[model samples]
Target chain A: MNSQPPAASTETSYGEAIRAGFVHLLSSHREVFAIGQGLWSPWYVGNSMTDLDKLFGKARVIDTPVSELACTGAAVGAALCGYRPIVIHPRMDFMVLAADQIINQAAKWHHMLGGQAIAPVTIRAIINRGGEQGAQHSQALHAWFAHIPGLRVVMPSSVADARDLLVASVLCDDPVLYIDDRWLYERKAVLPAVSERPLAAEGPRVVRSGTDITLVGAGYSSWLCEQAAEILAAEGLDAEVIDVRVLNPFDPAVILASVSRTGRLCVVDGGWRNAGWAGEVIASVAEALDPRQLKSSPRRITLPNAPAPTSRMLEADYYIDAGHVAAAARTMLAARETAS
Target chain B: MSHRHWQSELAGLADPAQYTAPLVIEAAQGTRLMGLLRSMLVIRHTEDQIGQLVVAGLARTPCHLGIGQEAVAVGVATQLRTTDRVFGNHRSHAHFLALGGTPTSLIAEVLGKASGTSRGMGGSMHLFGREFGFHGSVPIVGATIPIATGAALAAKLDGGDSVAVAFFGDGATEEGVFHESMNLAAVHDLPVLFVCENNLFSSHLDIELRQPSDRISRYAEAHRVRSLTVDGNDLLAVEAAANALITGIRQGAGPALLEAVTYRFRGHVGPNEDIDVGVHRRMADVSAWKRRCPIKRLSEGLLAAGIVSGDELAALEREVVAKITDAVTLARRADYPDPSALHDLVYACRP
Candidate 1:
């Protein structure tokens, strides 16, 4: 497993990395354009696409009206016309209004056309939660999209990947759902120079390696796993951290391999517990490995299967944090040692 | 004008006598008129054969036939090039055939043959012929309207005179995306034409029950898109209106809507006349609408103008029938796609 240690050089925030990605795409490729609601406003999209309409022309970075369905469908249409368009939905909750276009039209176009055409459109859906946003505003529905057949679901947990994956998704000739969390935007890391690579070359990556327990997560959950690994390391309980970069087309090779050595698994998912991505990861590991190989039963930490509450106190208990993940890993280790 | 004014005009056109008269074909328009007539004939006969296939239980897919509404597609497609993007809805056989899509490929598609337009992947509702400028058609109502609008945005950005055309029905106007697409195209000044083939019924329900008014152009007007409502069964009217709107679009006049008021001879699905569905669609209404058939009207007008003799008209009919018969035979004999290749096109291979 290769670890991506931050270099001692210039640092970039996850939000700024996304901005730099847009800069690279717009400056290098003329066929690429960004369109959606509040693209020109910083308050809605944070510092990710700051003043892109000015750097590029307003025509290229279009700020459309509050018409999610039309804007998404239009981006798909432009993609069909051989342009790589990124349609941003500031809040992932309202993106459900445009699900028909994303699911039925864009995702099915390439296959429906018998591979004669492709809608190389990237849908940048931001997961906005916390601060008492209520149920309507808080959602990370990546699992629903990941279940789709044709769509490529990508969630970048690292700062470098936040930028590079956005670049790769746009350049890719398939409809990709690029999910970025606002909580990860503040993350900073010293990065290498931008190197364009195919999204197919990316999958589950091990960020931190240890043989005690296998910790798996995606998006914000992946970041929590990193923090949990640090906490576990200080207590002499070594944990291996695996960030699921690409959810769909998910390869269980890395996670399965890690579980084989550690003989223990714990997955953290930001989505709901029922039919969540955490279950999928655990299922993959359980389906492959023999029960005798596993010293303890696998475990998954996820949000409760209920709507998000508005009060901050309720939210503190509702959402799973790094502490929750660390505790879950400790419990698994303790249980396995006791069983032995 | 007031909203009532447009509704009154639509009501006037809906009168059966308004479309019974022969079209006025001039000497200079003989060739173009003949081409339009031939194309409409091809669509009608081709759909008639598809109905036969449905009756014979050969075609398993849901087929939406636009038998009487051929003038809308034939008229609009005649003025478009292979580069101009075109989109359609569930009832899109006319749109496909009018844009030079072969009867063999279309029938092969309906039959789920390897030689089909969608390579046997997409059936009747999901047809694609990008080479002929028919981008695709989906069963989802009002799905492709915004797609066509976006294609227009690309056409505008490409700095080309090419435009995009979206062919939908009056029922599609009820979809929120339809109005949203119009607004987007208008705000961006996109080069797109919204062609609404208003047969006045969404499935078994009449438009009067669905909306405050049966006229769909009012929605276009609400979006400030310049629109024209014409007798869709009249070939000359549809052609002229489509030509004018397309010309304006090419000249950077934003988007335009052409609402062609026409009817379907067959049911919403399959081969029956649907007169006995026990809905508002009575046999009397169907019989009257058939009398105002677009193909019959155009053929009579051409004959009256001395563009073609009686024998020539008969020969054209025979020729179209024989051609479609041969195409259907070939399509029926073609092989179905191998089951192993089903997953090949789910994702595009990286270049």
Candidate 2:
């Protein structure tokens, strides 16, 4: 197993890395255009698209009106006509308005045209959770988009993955849905001078490795798993942290190998538990590995099947955090002891 | 036919008779006019064949026939170059045929044959022909409208006068995407021509029941897009309106909406008139609109001007029938897609 440390040369926030990545792509490629409702506005788009209009001019960095469906459809059309268009949906909730274009036109165009036509449109949908944003605005609709056939769904957890994945998705020739959680925008991590990860990559990555139990997550949950691994380390439990970055072209080889060695698995997901992405992971691992691999049944840590509550207390209880992940890992370890 | 019943049905819209004026071929480009007439006849005969196939239960797909709406497509296509992008809604036989997509490929697609335009993948509602600049058509109400707008944006960015045309129904105007697309095109000054074939019925429901007024071009006006409303069945009128709008779009004057007030001779789905579906579609209005048939009106003008004799028109009809017959036979003989080929084209992996 070639489990080496991430090549970190400097430290940076996730938001900074994403912003820098876009800036670099826009500078290098003349065909790429950053367009959305509040791309130029500081308050609406945070530091991700900050000063992009000033740097690349308004034509390349367009600030569109509050028209998600048309704008997103326009982006798809532009991509079909040989322009690499990056559309920011700012919130996943609003992206639902443009689902027809994204799912029907962008995703199916290549196949519908018998591979003669392709839409290289990257939709950066931000998962803005918590803080009384209410049910409508606060949603992680990664599983919904992942259910689609011809879409490349990716959730980057760390600053490095965020930077590299964004660049890869922009350059990829297929329709890519790059999901990023707003909560992790401030999270800081060491930055590699060059991409330490795979360039034309697909599948999960082992952020932290161990022998006992495996904690699998994607996007926000992946970061939580990393923190949970730290807490588990203090508790003398060696839990492996695997971030399933690309969910659509998801290769289960790395995950299956990790599970076969570790013998215990705890899948963490930001979305609801029932029929969620985490369930797919757990199901695949269970179907692959032998029962005599000799450990406890895999557990899935996810939100209950309910709309996002507005109250801060309910919000806190509703979401799955690092502590929750740590507790799930400990429960799996305890089950292992009982089985032994 | 009860004129009172028809009048009540078409109460708000302008007089349908005024728009359906008998075409005049006097000094009109005789060869081009004759070509347009032949194209209309081909569409009419092709649709008639489809209607028969649908009744025979040979065609299992849902076919939205544009029987009486031939002039709108023929007229618009007259102004379009092979390089300009054109998109269509569920009913798009004329749009494809007018753009020179082979009748055999279209019939093959409907029959789910490998020789189909979409390679038997997308049956009737979904059509694809990019070589003729007829970019794929979707069944979704307002789906391809914005796509055409984006294509126009791309054309502008590519530094050319290439125009993007979206052919949709008046029913699609109810979709927010239509309004958004119009606004986006207007805001960007993109070279897009929004063509709304207002057949006045959204499936089974009448436009009277759907909107306050039958004039859908008002929505185009709301978006600040220059629009022209004409008798869609009148080939000359539609051709003139489309020519002006397309010319402006090519000159970079921005997006324009051409509302062609036309009617479908058949049902929303399948071949029948669809009045049996308990909907409020007036039989009298159907009869009245029949007199304003685009093909009949254009032929009448051609005949009056002696541009095309009755014998020539008969020969043209025979030729079209033979052509469609041959296409149907070829489509029937074509193979179904290979079973192992099912996994292909889901994602276009970059080579």
Candidate 3:
């Protein structure tokens, strides 16, 4: 788990991690399959859909047309047909064009249809490096889905979590919004033999722990927070780190428990400030906590409310790095001193 | 209920009338009979209003009004129950209302009011009344057909007899999923009724211009499923076909197709039938098609049969108009969904 991209195998950059989980999903469920835009169209721009075409064959691993709306509608079609489909979100932006399918149809069909229709569809969205990709390409917009009721949002930070969540997603009865971080694509680790069912496929999991400030993060930011926590421990502040595997059905009890124990909180999120997932987490922590729980006001470190710049120099200026997260935690602690 | 023939369900795509043109019905009688008429009328008026509403700027969503297409819904839905599932396409007002969904909720939905069928989030095209067994309707043509077919497969797994229905237009036949849905539904012996309202148009392009034959039954025939084509304007015909075929399906007759040939008086979308896309449209054909109005034709037969007098028919019209008016008022007065609720519906609620 370094900055070096893992050797690209016969699989595409995104495919190395996806291959294991998708293969597991296919073998386990007679009804489950992986499908999406480039599913057969030859090029998987963001999804590591390499060798998938070979594994599942053309019928199951379908590559569709440029019609995102039609493609999404087809997913609903496939899903309603008792097929558990892992739908490709191609880009964070493509979903916007197909909102009617996901937001209006697939997401609400079960509840709206009075449980008569269950859309057990999984959407895989990739948030590539949010900084250099500019406005559209760089968004870690799990916050866009942070409020839907019927969806389970899972953003895995490790290879096993990545692989296991895919299998678990296929197994779950509800629809899942599974986000893969392109920034971490080709990043490798030893995957656990992913259980078909583990308790937290759509819930949070603690990656590492400490006793000072609890740092919660998801997807790419989860790894970033880990590095930031290391810097914090070196600074003599023991910050615990929690990987919020899921965003919407967020594990508030676990987060609050950590906050109750540590008596402080700092969140690092890749999505932009204001309306991002970090803001919601901050709100959730604030809403859940009373006067009894804290030694400091909770802090959130995220990309500033500005367009992602293309140049490396501008990215360093715009996006949040480990140094920024460590700085924010210290600032929260320092501000805690004045208030006390 | 014993269906030894166990016919292929999609054959109706080929032989349109075989499944829908039945002159036989048994022991059908009061609120149940009247309920059928009421549903047809409600479909007519609601769609008529939807046309006006779209032009009036009250409803912004694309509205596929099934105005001249009421009998098919009342006919098909009469044979269905709450436990059974039904799905429709862009033209689903009749499908939803006939299945016993509220007019106020539908109107509110068209108006984007909180009390709408989808809680004001999904407009007229995407109606979901899961409690009443109306699963959903999609704007994407033929999208929900396969889903309904799939749901039927699920119901089969659960055992016992429950049928799934997919109500689409002739235009949807062009989509590959329609055939896929039919093939899958038949091959699995899933108990589903594919009801196609062939009004001879895909939006503005007439089916004649788009298709080689005026008939859509051939596709259903190609699939080797049981097929029925009927004058969708005839309620008795629609009802008899649906009733007879539905019992067979529920008795494990497998999949079947009932193609009801009907027309929508309105445009491919919104209220105006000729919303300026006059390319292949003939006002004359629209007029000719209007004469085949399912409601009018039914009333004429009822009147000829002395089912009621002119005064009684007048009274019924008044009641339907009143209901439409009330629905409009309520929908207009109803609130828009909370902007916050926008985020709430996409996922299942969890603690």
Candidate 4:
């Protein structure tokens, strides 16, 4: 299913890379279709799916009614009938309305059918945060889905993965929850031609190399870790950055190796503190490694366990950014130095 | 205008004795009518065997018996093809059997054997008979309505005449997704038949207490889809309505609804008549509903039409009982799935 590789890489934003993925999949595959709310409207879904309906025809790129459960369940049914469909939920918070179809139906269909059937549907849930959206509008519930036994959760942190992971997800015969962050849409990179690969081959990658501390994150949190690594570099503390691309069926080999070498760990997560993806990452590392190997105890920078406040002033304290990650990394190093 | 109540118009139909008249058998329907009767008998006997299994403690799964609601499934299945997809709710044994699913596979599934339809992973609530056009069934009420709608969308996109069917109960209409699916199917003009087997009760709660109206086809009207309500105990009525609606759907007439106002002789979940659970249900209602059994009415019609003799009807019952007994014996002999391969099917292709 690999398309022809481009002769040279082209500069592309994260949002455009996603569009490129959709374009490539729709152009190449006949069975692929996209269905969801606001798929045709740029104001709702941003530049990611702009004019896709016009490009691929309204039949293939369906802009459905504002029924989350029905649309999601419809996409699943289409998938069962030999169609590869991508159901886009404009916001992760509202996607909760269709949690039954996603968690119970899509995820369990193959297993419950004893491998006789497959719901090869990709659910693209975008995390829209900040700008005083508050509470119901802002959430990153990737942990809840990653906890499911039958789901494959992918969070694309880099521009190349933004496009490539979307391609891999739709082509995959299993249901995948491909989460993208609105915060990382502006980040640009030179993306190569779409080189299709199995989703199983993708996992955590060491984006930056260092020896002092390891920064682990996925999606926007991975972007924060990259920014934090740059800040730590200026402060004479070299930090290794690991992007956990696939949250479900998470391969801790890369992160374990990075933390084993760096001797310190600080995870940056966009979700809440308790029972969060950050905690799962920490637990995975803790389960595999001995305590004596680390220079200091692991630290995690996450949102407070409270609903997002609407006030602009409180928003600054509510959301986790690069500065918080940098500060947390600095404190972890400082604590290790004091102990030594 | 003051709103007219459904209880008054529907009172005669639900009286149990009202629709006991034998079916008007046409010369052309002799073979077809007997086939329908055989299908309903198969479901009744198969579920009867399952009921016995539940009583004997051999069936550990939660078995929702559609004992008296067999006509709805058999009637609808007669109009469907192998290419036309069908989905069922929790009470789906009748649906499966009517769609040509073997009793052995279903019994094996309930017994947690390797030969089960779901390979013993899913019990009575979850079943898949893809060859018979049964996509699957789940215990979640109204969950498959949208799924069948989606399948209809697929059928439309595939440029085929095949339609999709969702068999749900009156209780499922209360779910928001059901309305959403109806609206979506109607809006898209998708070929889907929404079959509501209005069994008068959602679990232990009666339809009167659950919804303002006892008639469920009004929801279809709310979505602007063509609909018909029929006496579910009458096999011919359901068959005729399903035939018209399914034909219309296949001919690009978009979605339709068939509300078969039926009754389950058994309780909500198991084989027992749950008259003690709620104030609305009683021994009288159960006995009255039993008198209006779909199998009995159809058999009486066949006898009245001289299509079969009294000895033939008795002999047919014995034949069905023996076949079900053999299926159960074989299902019991089937081995259980290996515990070592518990995680074999977690994902189609594990990452």
Over A1-340, each residue of candidate 2 has an lDDT whose tens digit, in order, gives 1134445554678887788779767877788998898987897866777788887888888889899999999998889888989999988999999999989889998776666788999999999999899899889988888998889999999997788888888888889999988888899978775342332366788999999998999999999999999999998999998999999866788899999999988999999988899999998898888987838888899989999999998998899889988987888798777867
Model 2 pairs whose backbones collide = none
- List runs of model 4 lying over 4 Å from the truth: A1-10, B1-11, B275-280
- Global lDDT for candidate 2? 0.86
- RMSD in Å for model 1: 3.3
Error of 2 at A82 (Å): 0.9
Task: State candidate 1's TM-score.
Answer: 0.97
Q: Is candidate 2 or candidate 3 better by DockQ?
A: 2
Docking quality category of candidate 2 according to DockQ thresholds: medium
**Clash pairs detected, candidate 4:** none
Model 3 bad stretches (over 4 Å)? A1-15, A41-47, A130-132, A198-202, A291-293, A334-340, B1-68, B74-86, B89-135, B138-291, B295-351
lDDT of each: 0.90, 0.86, 0.74, 0.90
Give the 10-residue window scoring lowest on summed lDDT in candidate 1 chain A.
A1-10
How high is each candidate's TM-score?
A: 0.97, 0.95, 0.63, 0.97
**Tens-place lDDT digits, model 4, residues B258-312:** 9998899888877888542443458788888888888888888888888988999
Best-fitting candidate, scored by DockQ: 4
- True-vs-predicted CA distance for residue A6, candidate 2, Å: 18
Q: On a 0 to 1 DockQ scale, where is model 2?
A: 0.62
The DockQ scores of all candidates, in the order shown, are: 0.69, 0.62, 0.12, 0.78
**Candidate 2 Cα misplacement greater than 4 A, ranges:** A1-9, A193-201, B1-21, B274-281
Candidate with maximal lDDT: 1
